[model samples]
Target chain A: MKKIVLSMVFMAIATLAMAQNATLPQNITIKALDGTSVQTSALQNDGKPMIISFWATWCKPCNRELNTIKEVYEEWQEETGVKLVAISIDDARSANRVKPHVDGNGWEYEVYLDQNQDFKRAMNVVNVPHTFVINGKGEIVWQHTSFVEGSEEELLEVVKKAAAETAE
Target chain B: MKTKQKHLPLLALLLATPFLGNAQGILGGHVTGNIQLDGQISHADSVIGAADVPEKLLMNARADILYTNGNFSAGLRFEAYQNPMLGFNSKYQGQGIANYFAAYNGDKLSVTMGNFYEQFGSGMILRAYEDRYLGVDNSLLGLNVTLRPIEGVTLKALAGKQRYYWEYGNGIVRGIDGEVNFNSIIKSMAESKFRLTMGAGFVSKYEPDQTISYTGNSAFRLKLPLNVGAGAIRADINYGNWSLQAEYAHKGQDPSIMNEFIYREGDALMLNATYSQKGFSANLQAKRVDNMSFKSVRTESGEMLYINYIPAITKQHTYAFLSMYPYATQTTGEMGLQADVMYKIKKETLLGGKYGTDIHLNGAIITGIDTNRIGGDGTLGYTSDWFKTGDLYYADASLEVAKKLSSKLKLTCTYGYQIFNPIVEGHEGNLHHNHILVGDLTWKIDKKNVLRFEAEWMGSDSKYDKNIDDKRCGDWIMGLVEYNFTSAWFVSVSDQYAYRDGVGNYYNISVGYNHGATRLQLGYGKQREGLLCIGGVCRQVPASNGLTFSLTTSF
Candidate 1:
C-alpha cells in the first residue's frame, strides 16, 4: 500500500509537471450564426467563472444539458454572476440549420459556431457535450466530458463555490 | 447571456487586460474568424437523384469575421460553392455570407437581432441550420430573446425566416421554449446519493409555403403561414453505477416540399440505460420514430431539411470493414435497439496473461415501423402511429478480443456478422450477409520507435448479379503497416484489394507529424463509397480517388 501510494503520487506529480509547463491553450474565434464573430479570449468573465460548452444540433445530450441550463441559467448568473458561452461545433453539413435549431429551442445562450473544428481541436475535444470552466486568470479550472440531465446544475454549484472563493 | 455582460463591463472597470487597451478605448474590440473548405472531383455516366450521382469536380468554402468590445458584437460569413458538392442544396451553387447577426448579453436578460439557429423540444416544430459537408444550410433571419426571472427556470423566444441556399427559408417562424430543473427548484434533491433531474419544452414554427402542388395544382391554397407545434419532456436519474434516461417528443402537421404534402405527422421516443464498475460496463439503448419528418421546405433532400434528429444508440465502430455499412437513423418510420458490454480481466491473474485480457460485445438492430396509408395517390396521405414494429432494415453483431503477449507486445482481433436489408433505407430491394475480420499487432522495440501492423478481410455472401452479369461475389483483404519515430512523426502505408467483385481496388498512403501543440497530415487514397459518421449523426461520402491534406494547431 505504501509503495502504491508513492507511485501514484509520483505519477500525478510528473503528469502535472509535464502539463504545467505546456503553453496556455489559446482561445478560439467563432462566428455567431447571425454573421457576427467573437474571439473566445476577448470575453472576460475570468474574474468570476466561465463555462464553455461544446454542442451540436444532432447531439441530444448537448441539447439536454443546454436546456437544463436554460431553465436555471439566469438565476445562477444573478446569484453568482457566472457566465457560460455555449459553443456550437456543427460542421458545414449542419451549419445552415443552426439558426432554426437554436431559434426553435428558444435557448437564451451566448452561442457561437466552431464550423471548422479549430476551436474543438484546440481544446482537445473528441466528443460533443464537452465543457470547461475557466477562472479569472484565463486558466482551465475545471473540465468534464459528457452530460446527464442534472449535470448542468451541478456544474453551476461548482462555479458558484469557485466564485465565492475568488471573492474571499 | 449573463456571462458576456458581467465580465466585459467588469473587466473594463478593473482594467484587468492590457491587450484590450488602445486608441479609442481601454477595452478594444476583438477579431475572430473561421473557414471551411470541401472540394471533390468525380466521374459517373448518369445520375438518378443521388443514388448514381455522376463524377464531377466540386468545391465549397466559407469564412467568417467578427469584431467586438464592451457589450456589442457583429460578424459575417463569406461562402463559395462552385458546383455544390453531392447532397448540397441545389440552389446554393452560388456563394456569400449565408448567415450573420448581432447581439447583447445581460444578467437577467439578453437580446439578439440577425440570423441564427433555434430549436424547441427536439426541434420538431421549428429548426433552421446548415451542414456544409452534406450541403445543407438553413440559417434564420430574425430576432431572439432570452429571459430569466428566477432560479431553476429559463425562457426563450424568437421569430425569423429560414435561410435557403444563399437566401432565406420560405416561411415565418416564431417559437418560445422553457425548461425547469427539479433539483434547482426543490433544493432537497441536492446532496443525495440518488440523483434525479427532469425538464420539458415547447416549440412552434410558421411558414407561408408557396401555394403549389405536385400535379400543378394549388394545395393549401390556404396561402397562410404554415403553423407546426411540438412539446417534449425528459427525465434522467442515476444511483451509484447505474443510470437511466428517456425523452418523448411530438410535432403537429405542416406540409412542405419534401414529403409532397404527405401529412406525415412527427413523434419520437428515446431511452438509454447504463451500468458500470471497476473493470466492467454494460449499456442498452432503444429509439422509435414515425412520420416525424418536419422541415421548413419539404422538398429539400439530404440532412438539411430535418426538423429533428433521432440519435442512433449503437456503439460506433473503428475497424474498416465493420464500419463500411454503418446504419443511418431513419427519421420517418424506424425503430432500433442496441446493446454493448465490455470487460477487462484483472491484472496478475492467470487469464489476464502478463498484462490483462479485454473483451467487448456489441449488437444493433434497426427496422422500419409498420404503417397504413390513409389517402389516395397524389393526395396528402396519413400514416399510423410510430413505435409499431415493421420489417427489419438492418442488424449487426460483433465481438472483440485483445491480449498482451508480453510487456512490449499486444494483439487485438475482432469479428462481426451483419444482416442488411436495403429497401428500408430508400434503397432497392436486396438483403445481404456481410462477414468481417480484423487483426492488429503492436510492437515497441524501444522508447523512440514503434511499429504496428493491421490486416482485415471482408466477405459478402450474395453480392453477385443474378441477371446477365459477369460480376461475382465480392471479397476484400487489406494490409496496413505503420512506423512511428519518437512521439512526433509517423508514416503509414495501406492497400485494400477487392480481389473478386467490386469495380475498383483502393490504395492509401498517409504521413503525419504531431508536435504537442500542432499536427499536420497528408494522404492519398482511392476512397470507397461509404457512410461517414461522427457522434450519432451520419452522412454518406461518395467513392473518390484523390489526395488530401490537413493541419491542426493550438496556441
Candidate 2:
C-alpha cells in the first residue's frame, strides 16, 4: 500500500514536469473508409495544421463532439488552413457503420478506420472523443479528452494557435 | 525472487527517464501516458440481492507510460487491483507492472519483444487484446515480428504464452500470417476499378498432456492431444460502392472442457457485404461456427484465454431498454445473419425538414446448427448439417428515426423487438420476447449549456422467476435527464423500475467535470444485476448499491 501511494505521487510529479512535444506517429497502417490501406505517417495536409479526432460509433460523446464541430468546421477551415481527420476505432463489427454515419451527417472530414486500434494504441488514446492538434511541422501541439457542449470552440482555439505558429 | 529484485533499479530508471529527458530539453523524443483510477464503496443490501462485501472499499487503477524515439519505442503498464471491484475477478488482486514491451520499427521490418496484442484475419483464428472495463487482458508474452517483404505484401510471425492473471498460461502459442494487396502488388491493378486483398494465417498451441476421465465410464482415462492447430484464409474485394469480405477457418480436433471434451473438428465461416451512396447505405453479414471454442488451456473456462473471436452480427444498441437483453455469442454451434440499412430523407421532402432526417433499420437472427448427437467421449460427439439451421436462439429488429426539430433541439425515437432463448446460456426454457421503445431529446440551450432527456419502456412476456433470478426478464421502464453547464461540468440522474412481475428499482445520480485531458466523475447508485457485454464478450455484474468515483488523465 505504501509503495502504491509513493508510485502515484511520483507519477503525478513526473507528469507535471513533462513537456508537450509529441510528434506524429509513424509506420502504422490503417484502413481508409474506401477499404484501402493507408499509412498513418503518410497522412499529410499540404503544410496545413490538422486536427485528429478519435471516435467510435457507439460513443455518444464522440458523436456529440463531432456533430458540434461539424456546425463550425467550415469557418474554422476558412479562418486557418486547418483540416480535420476523424479516426474510427470501431473494430470489425461496427466498422461498416462509420462511412454511412459520417456521410449522413454531412461531415466533411477525412475518415479512416483503425479496426485493430494500432494507431490508437500508438497515440496513447485511452478513450474516445480524444482530439489532437498537429502543427505544420507535424508536431502534436495540443490534445484533449472527452467533450462538453462547447468543447469544439476550445479545439478551434488550439487549431488557430497551431496555424499562427506555422505562419510565423 | 533475487532476479526480480535485481531489476528494481532498472524499473526505477525507466520510470524516471521521461522526467529527466524533459528537464534536459531532449530533442526528437516524446513521452506519453495515461492513468485511470476507479474506486467503489458498497454496503450489503438484501433487497437488491447484493452480497456482503468483505472489503468495504475496492479499487482498480492502471497507469500506462510510453516512450518513443524515431523508430524505436517502449511502454509499460502498471496495474493495481486492490481487492478488485465487484464484477471483476477476485484473482486480480495486488499490483505490479502487468505489461511491458519494447519494439523497433524499420523501413520494412518491425520486431516487438515482451508483451503484445495481435490479431489475424478478422480474429477468427487468433486475437489477443485487452478490455480493462471487462477485466480481460490476453496479451501474449514473447516476441512478434512483422516483415514487409515487398510492396503490398506483409507477413507476421509470433511466439508467446498468453497472460493468465499475473501468471502466464500453461500452453505455448505460435502463429504466422501473411497478406497481399493485389492492387498494390500488380502495377496494372493499381488503377483498376476493382480492389482485392487476400490473407492466410496458421496458429498452433502446445500444452502438456493431461488425463481426462470419461463422463459415463469414470474408470477409463484418455490423454489429450499435446498440440492443437487452426488455420484461416480471408479475402476482401471492393468495386465502387460495393464491397465484400469473407473468412473461413478450420481447427484440428481437440478435446476441451467447453465442448464437453468432444473431439469434433472446429470450423467457422463469416461473410459481410456492404453498399453505400451519399444518401443510402446497407450492410449484410452472415456467420457460422461449429465447435470453435479454441482456448489456450483445455480445462480453462471463462472470459479469458480465448484463442479466437466469434463475431457478433447484431446491432449494438445505445438506448437503455434496447440493451436490456444482450445476446452472447454461442461459439459451439450457431449460425447468424444481420442486415442494416440507413437512409436520409433529403431536405425539403415531406418527411424531411430543412435539415433533413435520418432513418436507420437493423435486424439480426441466430440459430443453432442442425446436429445429431453421437457418443460423447472418444468420439466426434455430433454430426451437424452444413446447410440446416436448428432451433432459433436469438433475434432482434430495430428501427430509429432522428430529426432536428429546430436548431436547438434534436429528437431521436427508436423501436426494438427482441426474441431470446435461455439456451444461449446453456439453460433450456421458453423463448423470451420483448418490445422496447425509446425517445431521446437533446436541446442545446446555448453555447455552454445543454440539456438532454431520455425515456425508455420495455414490455416482455417472460416474467421474472425467483428460481431463475434473471432480473432482465420482467417489464421495465427507465428515464434519464442530464444537464451540462459551463462546457466542463455535467450532472445526470437516471432510474430504472421493474413494475410488473418483478420487484426492483435502480436509481443513479452522477456528476462529472472535465478539463483538458483529465476527467473526474462521481456517482452513487443502485445497480441491477445483468450481463454487461462489449462486442460479443459478456461479463456478469452482480447487483450492488455503492458510491463510485473514477478519475482519468492522459499526457
Candidate 3:
C-alpha cells in the first residue's frame, strides 16, 4: 500500500509537469438524432466556435444546464455565431427517448446520442454536465464540469474569445 | 519487498522525466485527464437500519492520465479505495493501476492494446463497459482492432479476458463485428428516400471445465459446455419521418450458476420503431428473451463479468417518488413492451399562454415467460412456450405536462401508476400497486439567480412490515428546494417522510461550487436504503447517516 501511494505521487507530479493544450479527438463514432452513425471528426460549425455538452436524460444538473443555455442561445448565436451541440450519454434503454424529450423541451440545439459512450471515452469526459469549447480550427480550447446559474455567461466569454481569434 | 524494489526505479524515472520534458515544451506531448475523490463519514443509526461502521471514514479516489502526441496515445487510470464506502463491493479494498491502454488511430485502421470497452449491435450478445458511479467496470484486457477499408464500412475484432475486481476472469472471450451503410456505399441510394444499415456479430467464450454435481441428486455429474458461442444480426431502416430497428441474437446451450446450471439454449429479440416531426414524436419498442444470461465466466454471478446486455423497456422516471420502485431487467426469461408519445402545444393558444406547453405520455409492461420443467438431472432444464406470457412482472403508465407560466417561471406536473411484483427478486408476495404525483416549479429570479421547488407524494397498496426489510412498500411524501447564486454556487435541501405504514425520515442538505474544470460538493444526510438503478442495471445502496464530500477536476 505504501509503495502504491508513492507511485501515485510520482505519477501526479509527472502529469502536472506535462500539461498542455487540449484538442478534439478524431475518428470516434457517435449517432445523430436520426440514428445515423456520424464521425466526431466531421463535426464543424462553419468556421464558428462551438460548444459541446455531455449530458444524460436522468441527470438533473445536465438538464438544468441545457435549459439555462436555451434561454440565451439565440442571442449568443447572433452575437458570436456560436453553436451548441448537446450530446447525450444515455445507453440503449433511454436512448430512444432523447428525441421526444428534446422536442418537448423546445431546445433549439444540435443534439446527438452517444449510446455506447465511444466518443465520451475518447474525449476523457468523467461525468455529465461536462462542457467543452472548441475554436473555429476544431481544436478544443476550454472546458468545465458541472453547472451553476451563471456559468453560461462564462461560456459565452470563452466563445467570444474563440470567435475573436478567428477574426484576427 | 521485491515488488517494492522493482517499482522504485520506475517511480524515480516517472518523476525525473517530466521535469526534463518541461524544459523542452515543444517536444512534450499534451497531457489531459480527470480526477474524482469521494469521502464519507458515517455513524450507526438503528432507526434507519444503518449498521455500525467500524472504519467510520471511507474514501474512493481515481485519477486518469492520458498523453497524446500525433496519432499515438496512451492512458492509465489509478484507483484507490481506502476501505470502500457502503454500497460498494468490498473486494475493491486496496489501490493499484486499475486500467491502462495504448492506441494508434489512422485513417483506415485503429488498434488498441490493453484495457478497452466495446459493444456490438444493441449489445444483445456482447458489451464490455464501465459505470464508475455504480462501481461496475467490466473492461476487456487485451487487443482490439477496428478497420474501415471503405467508406461507410466498419469492421471490429477483439480478443480478451474481462477484468474481475483486480484480476482477470477465468474465461477467454473473442468477438468480431461488421457494419455497413447501404446508402453511403452506393451513389444512387445516397439521395433516395430510404436509408439502411446492417450489422452482425459473433462472440464466443472459452473456459476450463469444472466438475459439477447435480443438487437434486448428488450422485449425478452434469456436463458443461467448455466453449459457448452467441451470434447476433441487426438492421436499421430510415425513411422520411419514420425509422425502425431490430436485432436478434441466439446462443448455444451453456451451463452457468445464474440459471442453476441449466443447459437451455438462449435467445433474445428486440424491435423498435419511431416517428417524429418538428413538434410531435412517437416510439414503440418490444423485446423477448429466453435464458439469455451471457457471462464471461460460467460459474460467476452478480453484476460482474457480464458479456451481454439486456435492456429493460420502461420509462425511467426522474422524480423522487416515481422512481422509488425502479424495475430491474429479467434476463433469463421475460417479454416486455413499451410505447411513448410527445406533443407540444404552440404558443399563444388557450393552453399555451405565451410559451408552449409540452405533454408526454408513456407506458410499459413486462411479464415472465411460460415455462415447464420437463427434464431430470443432466438434461435441458425446461421447455417454454413461444408466445405465452406467464405472469405480470411489472407495469407502469405515466403522463407529464410542462408549461411556461411566464418568462421567468416554469411548471411541470407528472402522474404515474405502477404495479410491481416481488417475485422478480425471488421474493414471494402479492403484487404492489402504487400511485405517484409530482409538481415541480422553477423560477428565474434574475439573470444570475434561480430557485426551484419540488413536491411529491406516493400512495401504495402494499404496507411496510417490520419483518420485511424493503422500505419502499409504503405511503411517502417528499419535498425539495434548491437555490442557485451567481451561476457558480448552489445549495439544496430535501426530505422524504413515510407518512403511513412505514417509519423513516430521510433528510439531506447539500452545498456545491463550480469553477472552470473543477467542482466541489459537500452534503450531510440520512439516506434510505434502496436499489439504485441506472438504465435497468441496479446495485443495492445501504441506508446511511453521514457526511459526504466529492471533488472533481480535469485538466
Candidate 4:
C-alpha cells in the first residue's frame, strides 16, 4: 500500500509540472459573526486584491500577527482598496470566544468562523497564521506560512503587486 | 534503517514539487498539499523522570495531497512515525496511507467514500475528529451522504467503522441527522430580527456479542445489548446582539468496561449565551455530563474509540503561568460553568491613555456530580440527583489588561488564581491553590526588526513529594526573550526555574527561519513532564533533555 501511494504521488508530480492559476474552491459554507452562513464564492473585493488569514483564539502568534496588521489596515485599505478577511479555526472548544477576542482587540477585518476547519483544509493550511493574497480575478497569487514582526510589510508588498497586476 | 530515513525527504520533495509554483495543474484541477516533519533526540534524565531511549532519534512525518475540481475533490494522507516519538502511542510506529477519501460536494447533494470526520450538534453525542498534537484521531472509515432538498434544510446519513491506529474497530456505527433554518425556510421570517436554527441527530453502534463471566464467577454470565443508541437535540437562536445555543443528549443502557460494566444510562447538557457589540462582549456557558463515555467497543478503555465528545467550558489560556494546570473534561460525571467579559476603554481618557486599554476577565468552576453507588456489574451502578452538587474539582479566575504604550511598543499584564484537585487525572492529593502573575512587552524596533520579553511568577501551596513525583508543585519563575530580524528569521531563549520546593530547571533556545509557505525550526531544550491537552483531550508527555527540529510547508 505504501509503495502504491508513493508511486501515485510521483505520477501526479510528473503531470503537474506546468502551472496554471487556480480559483478558490466554491460550495463551501462558513459562518459570519452573526451566525449567518456565507458562501466562499462570495468573498470578493470588487476586483481588488484580498488578504485572507487563518487564525485561532488560542494561538498567541496568530493574535500578534492580526493585531499588527490591524494597526496599518486603514492606511493599506486607502492605498490599495484591499480587504482583509480573518477566519477563526477555534472549533467547538473556543469558537464562542472569537467574536469577543476580535472585538476586544478592536480589529475591523471581516471575521468568520470555521468551526470544523473545513475552509482550512480546503486551503491546505497546515498551521495557523497562514496568509494568502488573491488577485482581482479571485485567483490565489501569493501565500505565506507563519509570521514574524515585519511580515506584514511583505504582505502589503504582495497586495500592492497583485493590485498592480490586476489594474493592467 | 538509514537508507529508509534518507528516502523520506526525497518522497516529501516529490509530493511537494507539483505545488511549488503556487499554481494548479493536472487537467485543470488544483493539486494542493502540505508536508510536516518533526524529529527529536533525547537523553535520559533521572531527576525529571525521563526514561532512557535506546533509539538515538525519533521522527514523525506526514504528507497530505488533495485534488479539487469544480465540485469534486479527492485527498489522501500518508503518515510515518519511525519508532514513534515519546508521548505518542507505540502502536503508531508503522506508517502508511492513514486516510483517503473521494467526495462530490455540489449545491444540493454530497457524498463521501472512505475516511471522513464529522460532528453533529456541537458533538455531544457524535464527533469524529482528529487532533494531531494530542495524538487523537477517531475519523470513521465508511460512507457519508448529505442532502439539501430545500433551502435552509440539510439532512445527513453515515455508516462506518471507527479507525483504530492503522486498522478499523470491530463495531459499526450508524447515524442520521437533520437541521433546519427557520428564517430561510419561512418567507415571513426572512426579514425578522430573530434567527433560529434547530437540529437533531441519532447515532447507534452495533457490536457482535461476546461471552463474559459475571464478576469472575465462572458459572454466571451477563447479557449484553448488541446495539447501543444515543440521541441529541440542539437549538441555536440569535436575536439582534444576543445569541444562545443549547444541546441535550441521552444514551441507552449498555454495560461497558469504561463504566465498569454498569448498565446505567448516560446523558449530557450544554448551554451557551453571548451578547456583543463593537467594542465590548460578554459570554456565559454551562455544561453537565453524566456517565457519557460512549465508545465503539465496550472492552476498549483507553483514549481511543470514543463515539462522543464533551467539550470543557473553561477558557483555554495562552499565557504560561495562567495555563499551568489545564483542565481535561470528565466524561463520566461532571458539571461546570464559565463566564467571560471583554471591554475596551476609550482612547484619550483618564485610564485609556492615547491608544485605549483592553480589559478581559474570565472565570470558571467545575465540580463532580453527586452520586450514590448502588451495585457493580449487571446492575444500575449508581444514582445521581440532577440538581445536587458534589466535590469541587477545579476553579480558576483571571484578568488581563493590555495597552499600546506607543506606536512602536505594547504592554500586557495579567493576574490569575486557580484551585485544582488531582483526582481528575486519576491521582489523589489535596487541592492545590496557586496564584500567578505575568507581564509582557513588545517593541517594534524597526520595520524589519522586533523584540518581545515576558516574565511570569507562580506561587503554589502544594509541596513536592517524592512519592508522587509531581513536578508541577512549588513556586516557579520563568523569563523569556525573543527577537525577529529580516522578516524571516527569529531566535528565542527561555528558562523556567522552580525557586522553592521543586527539583528541576528547564531551559530552552530555538531559532526559526521562514520563507513563502515553508518554515523550519531547530531547538535544544529541557522539557518538563506534563499533560499536553487540546480541547479537554490530553496525552501524557514525559520529561526529556532533547534536541528537536521541525519543518512544515504547504502549497
- In order, candidate lDDTs are 0.60, 0.81, 0.81, 0.82
In TM-score terms, candidate 3 sits at 0.93
Per-residue lDDT of model 1, residues B1-555, tens digit only: 001121223222222222234335322344333454556554442211122335355665666544333444444556777756655656677764455566555445656677666544334344555444455556667887776566545577887776666555565666676755455567786555565656566666655555554455555342333677767777666677676667788877655555555655567887767776545767777878776676655456655545455555554565667776667767666888887776777668988866677777889888888877776324446666555788888899989887767756768899999887766556575687889999977676765566778899989865545452212236778888877665356677887776765434567676766543344555566555544322111234545556544443322
Pairs of colliding residues, candidate 2: none
**Compared with the true structure, what per-residue lDDT tens digits does model 4 show for residues B1-555?**
212232443444544543553345445677788898888898887776667778979888889887776677777788898977777888788877788777777888878787888888788888898877566889999998988888788888999999888778899999999988888899999999899989999999999998767997889877999999999999889898788989999999978988888899999999989888877999999989999999999899888899898888898877666776889899889999999999999989999999898898999999999999999898899999998978999999999998898988899999999999999988999999999999988888988888888999999999899998888899999988888885578788888899998777888887888787788877788866453221111223445579977788887
The all-Cα superposition gives candidate 3 an RMSD in Å to the true structure of 3.7
Tell me model 4's lDDT, rounded to 2 decimals.
Answer: 0.82
Better of 1 and 3 by DockQ: 3
lDDT of 3 by residue, B1-555 (tens): 001143344444443443454445434456677898988899987667766789999888898876665555667788888878777788888887788777777767889888898989889999998988778898999999999888889899999999997778999999999999888899999888798999999999999887788875667777788999999999988888788889999999878887778788999999998887777888899999998999989878878999998988898776778878879898889999999998888889888778888888999999999999977546688998889998999999999988888877889899999999999987888899999999988887887888888999999998887676677878999998888776567788889999998778989887888777777877788876554221111223445689978787887
Q: Candidate 2 residues B1-555, lDDT tens each?
A: 101132344555554554464444344566688899988888887656666788798888999887776676778788888878877887788778788887777668889888898889678889988877778898999999999878788899999999988778999999999989999989999998799999999999999986788775778877688899999999888888788889999999878889988899999999988887777888889999999998999889888888788867787776767877778888888999999888889888889978788898999999999999998877899999999999999999999998888888989899999999998887777899999999988888988888888899999998878777776778899998888875578888889999997767889887888777777877788876454221111223445688878788887
Q: DockQ score of candidate 3?
A: 0.41
Give the number of the best model, judged by DockQ.
Answer: 4
DockQ-better candidate, 1 vs 4: 4
What is the descending DockQ order? 4, 3, 2, 1
TM-scores, one per candidate: 0.69, 0.93, 0.93, 0.93
In candidate 2, stretches whose alpha carbon ends up further than 4 angstroms from where it belongs are A1-17, A104-106, B1-26, B216-218, B528-543
Which pairs, if any, clash in model 3?
Answer: A149-B487, A150-B487
Candidates 3 and 4 compared by DockQ, better number = 4
